[model samples]
Target: MAGVNDQRDDRALRADCGSCFGLCCVALPFSASADFAIDKDAGKPCSNLQTDFRCGIHTRLRQSGFPGCTVYDCFGAGQKVSQVTFGGTDWRQAPETASQMFAVFPVVRRLHELLRYLTEALTLHPARALHGELRRLLEETERLTGLGPDALEKLDVATHRQDVNVLLLRTSELVRAEASGTMKDGRKKDRKKDRRGADLVGARLRGADLRGADLRGAYLIAADLTGADLRLADLIGADLRDANLAGADLTGSIFLTQPQLNAAKGDLSTRVPPGLTRPAHWS
Candidate 1:
């Protein structure tokens, strides 16, 4: 029952750029690096942002040296802050509202991210024992997203995120424990997968049975994970930049974020969890 509700919520949590006022372009800062061409400070609109609140080089963001922009997803928080919290008033039109709006954007973005994880957790049948708690946290997180600008600006997002992470960690444990039990008999002996913080850059791991693996904080830059079975794997903070994900199955992957997928290379055959869109660059 809660699973059904989660699927519905998932759609709303996706980024609707057309409905947004380009808050990401103005509210977030980026340092000059391989991912971005130029330095931008918080609250200052990106030089590429046009009068219509759209990226001037949206079609050629990567070519324009703004690859970082391609991976950013606000989880629909931009539009919610623009239309709902501020009542459809844009920061440009009302300059006085700019600071508060900027402050609230990140807070709501974090809440929406937590909601995304909670929604995904609810879908894990193996974690059914924790579904009730996941649903409750999802509801609470959703409520936080609906708070007004003043309340949102005052929110302690870090503390709330810590609280939510506890539930997510528990959910991951339950789901992965089940996955471990189902591993092939021969591989069971070698299933003590704890690769946290491993430097796996450009590693050839095609078709690897990485189910229930702890890949948290692993540096997988340009790694080949083609046809990999990543079910129940914890990908929190894993650097997937330029990684190949063609034919990889990440359906039940835990803590995998849209930005992480966007940073990697994948194809139509790559299977992702619900609510995540395949990267446009993927074949």
Candidate 2:
């Protein structure tokens, strides 16, 4: 039942806005574009953020012309920084700590993203050979997340992510190798569909059969993926920002992360894996 336990833990590690102090809304900046309605600067509280630290347009972010907000997920970093790192202190209550708090938020956010992938990698039975290494990295990453604000602000997240990427690549290869066997003639046809590091920005891929495809690090920005069959596909590090996934099926996709999903557009019919949730803005 390790997989079941892992799924439960995944839920806990997800973005819990209820427990957060609007860190993403305040710490991050966005420019006025098709995705966002207004330009905002880092360290400034979003105009829509309420005194209670909740988005005023939470229920109608898209309608309010702030579709970007609907797709952002802090991956539980907001609450961890606000409650654990800052000792539950609000920025409004202690203005002096605001600068350091904003600086540390993104650092821990990256660490939490790594933890999410490592946790999922551990659940793949085909990658059992690498489970020990995954666990060790997971523990080390988790320890980094528990560091104080000063330590977190000074963390080298890019270096840490580079280290974790090596094991993640191995895990993806192991799991996808088993999936490749289920392809036609067992000839690895999907391997030919590799789109690694390809710039697919706004590509018209509607209804494309991308099952079992290797899409690691693909730039899918604003691509139309409606009705695409993405089952068993490895989407690790894929930039799905603004990608249309209204009717796409991702039920068995491997290495897909919540942040990737959170950045995409999907509807009620879009089938996600077990641990991920459907985006609320989807009609």
Candidate 3:
């Protein structure tokens, strides 16, 4: 969402909470569950949202029965929707724009998520063959993020997501085959390790060698991965909630997002990508 008429980088994709207008606290809805203690309707500000548009429980969200808040990320969409889209005019400043802003924020958030993945895809050496198309899609997605609110609300995001998913699938094939020893003598194996959309909740996978595994959309919630090797694994859309990664190796995992890691359990012995930071709770 930060690619306005210039070159963009990872910094643009990282959320700067200070530059936001508490859009996540007000624009999104939540129901009482393990993730939240109370139910909240969309378009209403959370009780913890301060007058300055900051979360009052910022430092103690997990203790306040709001662990979901800590895991959720707007991927810099909040600042872009608040500053760039509305030109620094928050929903409170101009109440008339509140509905439109709230409606458009989610749309832009999805687009920004796509942009993040596209940006990451362009960095993969194995995906160099598809860099031209990836770059084209990235630029186009960035351009879409800069569109007006009306256009954004009316955007066919699903169709665009389908296009991106197609390319990502192909990119995964190239990278995984090269790193996982699944390709031999110009012949590709059937990928016996494929676990796309698998349900492995609470399963034991300790010390498993999962290098370059296709784990897209896998349900790994509460699974054990202690001392496991997950290098070069495809983790996009994987539900890693409460998964244990103590002493696991994820040095080259592909498409592993911050939110997924934030929801998981890990220790200092766990090795992640260079660009990612270990969660404070993963002591």
Candidate 4:
């Protein structure tokens, strides 16, 4: 739960894939599974990715059982690089630039990820005092991302992540500083003590009880009934990538997906997993 001020700045982040050069799908590898139809090497395109730089199976990704692709979000790094850094040049038109673009893709991705987290942290009132520091770090990171290919290639992302992580911890402390003494509500929350191996698939749980519930290894695929309760739920290894959660209560569902949460619905009070975006319809 955010203080009064945090709720006021509840703008959600979104991935503009068009602005990106299909980096994550191309630059990263994925195992063939229900989410991905086939194996792909790092810096290789998925078969479903199109020449126009859009997912060919976008509409049917979930229907075709490639739910993972539907849930993936690049945190707006795609457009930031494609439009901002490369000036809308794609790999197909200039194949010679693929190597540099690939190298810079992950680099800009890290920076964009930092932007997502810092932007979210800035929403909390207790963390408001860190706004200046956050802004400074954000600007520095943004500036570094805009450097030339050679300069960006030589940048040490690992060291930068370590420094940024420190700021993230401070931001977490600020968000949770005020709610130190509140008791966990039981009725509208998941029981985290023991709910291991539960089969909650397609369950009608809109606004249902689930505070502090242990939902490790649970199968929650295709579940309906949005706006359900999920406060303080221990969701380690839980499969919720494609579950519908529009307006659902998820204040503290630990280890959940940003893509899962992004596809669902929630607001500022809906505590989501780190490095993820809020759903589009969240209020």
Candidate 5:
């Protein structure tokens, strides 16, 4: 379960735009849709971005047709690169640094995400057996994030992610198995084997009994998950855009990020994992 320690660690994983160099506004691309007002190419600055790296439409992103911006987070990678990787030099001041900073931003973001998961894995009581390995990997991942731009860009992030996922999958099993416990027949039947990557987009799943479900990479966009019992579910890479989660019990849910919550629809009755904050818009 999420706790005070997790919330404390979350401070470092959150975006501090004031310390960033507007990387997300330039490093990522977006299409013209309900989320964005224009088609922006990677490395190109958004028109709404200010000289100070703040969004001009910050307070009204959704109202100004850049709703996607509201859900986007660099997981503190923007500041780490801008302030540490590039040594506090603004890309505008050092035109030559722009390309590399933009390139390294995404790489570090991926590493930080892995770090986030590793940190959480170490906190799982059921995964205590794996805590030593998790701590070592967490240290290793932290070290990798501090490497120079050239080293970072050249790093085989996918291979490292595979290695991390191997441990994470095991950690997930340990945690879920404890949550699952033994059924009357002396077997664990709480988990379903085929829920990973399920195409449940827009499916009516209100009030479903989904405890301990392996929902990795599930396309749950626009699904009606209202009042669903999602305790101990694995939600990594789940697309929750517009999914109704009002009154849903998500306590003990794994790998559900803030960006996912931002994209989903929920109410005050929604029970999130302890470390996550309820989206202000939910009010």
Candidate 6:
């Protein structure tokens, strides 16, 4: 029962990446591989990164064998922590600042990630009544971004994430309030789970049913969707780095990530993600 608002909110969150700093390239490490043909140490700028922090190979990342770059998302925390909080000073200028910035980056990332989810969840018609609550949380998160570096670094990110998850649980309850009634008589039998275009990074969706799902363009980085049922799902354009699909059923799933398939238990019945090769076991 996804609605137009949910779709619109999802698109808005995805397109809001311009406001972030290019922290991913600098904060993360990458080794030479089909996805990245060079070694990049954490805190060291990629060779393709320009003085202004823009990716020189952005246009040709995929064409140049850097498919990993195409699927990376920082949840808008990179720029905020880099420019607004720390005043755009990189680790090169002040190496001591790296630890603090790095620590705060992940925390702010969690906040922004929650923001993305809440914003999307608010779009559902069933959750419209809680729009005010959502708006309050969103505004609070926005205000946090404006805090000084010291204050930002001192934040209790785990507490904030827990508080936000409570609100999200309320949101989920509101959205699925009537689903139980629909489930009894097989009212939901015809309704397929459409995870298409979702951003499920580091999410824990274990043991979920996702038959005939359309997961195209989904961002599932580090997601623990272990033991989930994904039969006949579409995964084209999906990003699945570090995702856990162990013991999951991908029978007839389409466009699954290469690493997930490589690490998971699948068979000839499993459908592979696009732009990736299936493991020998799957064949």
Ranking by lDDT: 3, 5, 1, 2, 4, 6
Residue 128 local lDDT, model 1: 89
* lDDT (tens digit, per residue) of candidate 4 on 151-270: 887899889877876776566555533333445653232213365677877776666656555566777766763766665464544667557666666664444546656454445555
Better of 1 and 4 by TM-score: 1
146, model 6: CA deviation in Å? 1.9
Off by over 4 Å in 2: 1-7, 182-188, 267-269
Q: How accurate is candidate 1 locally (lDDT)?
A: 0.86
Clashing residue pairs found in predicted model 6: 21-79, 255-272, 255-273, 256-272, 256-273
State the displacement of the C-alpha of residue 111, model 1, in Å, after optimal TM-score superposition: 0.7
Worst 10 residues of 2 by lDDT: 1-10
Steric overlap count per candidate? 0, 0, 0, 18, 0, 5
lDDT of every predicted structure (CA atoms): 0.86, 0.85, 0.88, 0.65, 0.88, 0.64
Q: Name the lDDT value of residue 214 in candidate 3.
A: 91
| Cα lDDT of model 2 by residue, 1-283, tens digit | 1132443356647778877888999999999997789999999988999999998988888788887776666778988998899999988899999999999999998898888889888888878899999999999999999999888888888999999999988887777665554556555545577788899999999998787678999999999999999887789889999899989999778878766887898898899998777866567
The TM-scores of all predictions, comma-separated, are 0.89, 0.90, 0.93, 0.68, 0.94, 0.58
For model 6, the superposed segments whose C-alpha errors exceed 4 Å read 1-21, 32-34, 88-99, 177-283
Report the Cα lDDT for candidate 2. 0.85
Tens-place lDDT per residue, model 6, 24-100, is: 77777899996698999876778887766678887777678787676555656776787677887776678888777
- Residue-wise lDDT of candidate 1 within 210-249, one digit each (tens)? 8878897899999999999888788987999999999999
* Candidates sorted on TM-score, descending: 5, 3, 2, 1, 4, 6
lDDT of 6 at 123: 59
Those runs of model 4 whose alpha carbons end farther than 4 Å from true positions after fitting are: 1-13, 182-248, 251-257, 260-283
Model 3: lDDT equals 0.88
Compared with the true structure, model 6 gives a TM-score of 0.58
The candidate 5 region of ten consecutive residues with least summed lDDT is 1-10
